[model samples]
Target: MYSISIITVGMNHLAYLKSLLHSLYIENHPKCSFEMIYIDNCSKDDSVKFIRENYPEVKIIENKQPLGFGENNNKGVFASTGKYIAIINPDIVIQKDSLDILLDYAEQHLQAGIIVPQLLNPDHSIQYSVRGFISIKTLTARILSKGKDNVNNKTVNEYLCKDLDFQKTQFVDWAIGAAFFMHRDTFAKLGGFDLDYFLYMEDEDMCLRCWKNNMPVIYCPQSTMIHNHLRGSSKLGKKAWLHIQSIITFFRKHGIKIKNSKEHTMSL
Candidate 1:
């Protein structure tokens, strides 16, 4: 089997795709055997044609219609023949051999069901990629004036793991799905992402399930990647509504967990 399958799903993100492909194929220079899989969700632009012409080595999965983030990534994982899988977004640019670093960490940390590199802004500042699991209070705080109050800020930060040291490798409640690396077997056992969430919170749901099933989500600071994190609109819009709905579904699946003492809450 290939060492890893780097899967990126895009929809009309040609500009981002160009940079991402360049980073992976040229700048990255993977150490082990790996396959590049790009799942195109029926983009009207020339995303498919560009990859076909320039990067013929990439395996393309063209969708008949646009699918959600989870579903699209699942298609790539299903097609992967690699021992490990890297599900990254098209907007993420590889940095400093980040994929190899995460791969090494995953191999050493057998308990990690979800292994992620530190996500950074273009200026190289660490992004708050890791977050504590959401609770009723956490959701309430966000909805009520976007956590402006101190009490609400504290509640929100608790979910965001604001106090954690970003420079260390540790166990986190969840990491954003934008750049997740994990064993193929572990992901299969978890049954991929829940299709119930079309966009948001699927990453949170996946990480929560990992802990429930004794697979810890790990954050490795040794490896880092740059991500274009879109802090979605706070106003009640299509994206915001999806985020709210996913929160409800998450709570429904697993009742209010106000901070489980059994699970590792901080760095290991």
Candidate 2:
């Protein structure tokens, strides 16, 4: 039996955080085989105090200085002592037996470096959480239709091969960072998420690194979790700015030059 460490980065989401902790407590997993770490990234609310009083079992890392997603998660990663590390968001709730399926998949597929479970919206609708590569066109389309509706919904299914008859686990270019699981050794090999990305696109950067190492990022629909993804860089104003900055940084760091609706410079 392999031990697992669950890491979550949160700030000011006390209500959702409590629900998340409670879900974990009732989740049908062997408690002796896993541990949870919450990194409070200088939250202005009473999240720290709340965790301290209620969830004493969770090891809380109080960040005196504010840290971004990648940095704060890295803090939790360093503190974890599990063979596999699960990067989860505070708003996601793992369904009963979800961890069992994920662990079983990981054990069966040794070549797969990173794994993502099927992500569902709050209403139990199938959310295409996996993605292909990113380009300027994708970025621009997403920017053009920011708050009104999901631009990705139009092309996400085809991109993720959801339209095909393939229902089994398959390799993917990238998986959303909302909920990701990978071996501790693989995380060390890839150096974890790049700290340069303050918030968005860190998952893409990490996926690119895993691809370079000839490791596959897999999507297993057998195991599913409801991801309340209405947080962070998806909000109205500041989220857009952070997203654009991260896009530009992602291209520059990966040497991908945008052309006519295509970024052909990147190898994978």
Once superposed on the true structure, which residue ranges of model 2 sit more than 4 Å away at CA? Answer: 30-32, 147-166, 257-268
Clashing pairs in 2: none
Please give the lDDT score for candidate 2: 0.77
Candidate-wise lDDT, in order: 0.84, 0.77
Number of clashing pairs per prediction, in order:
0, 0
Clashes by residue pair, model 1: none
Residues 1-268, model 1: lDDT tens digits: 9989989998898999998889888998778789989999989899999999999999999999889888988889999999998998999999867888988888877777889889998888777778877787777777775633234367777766778889977777788888999999988988998898898889988888888788888888988889887566455688888888888888898888644423555344
**Per-model RMSD to reference:** 2.5, 4.1
Give the TM-score (vs. native) of candidate 1: 0.92
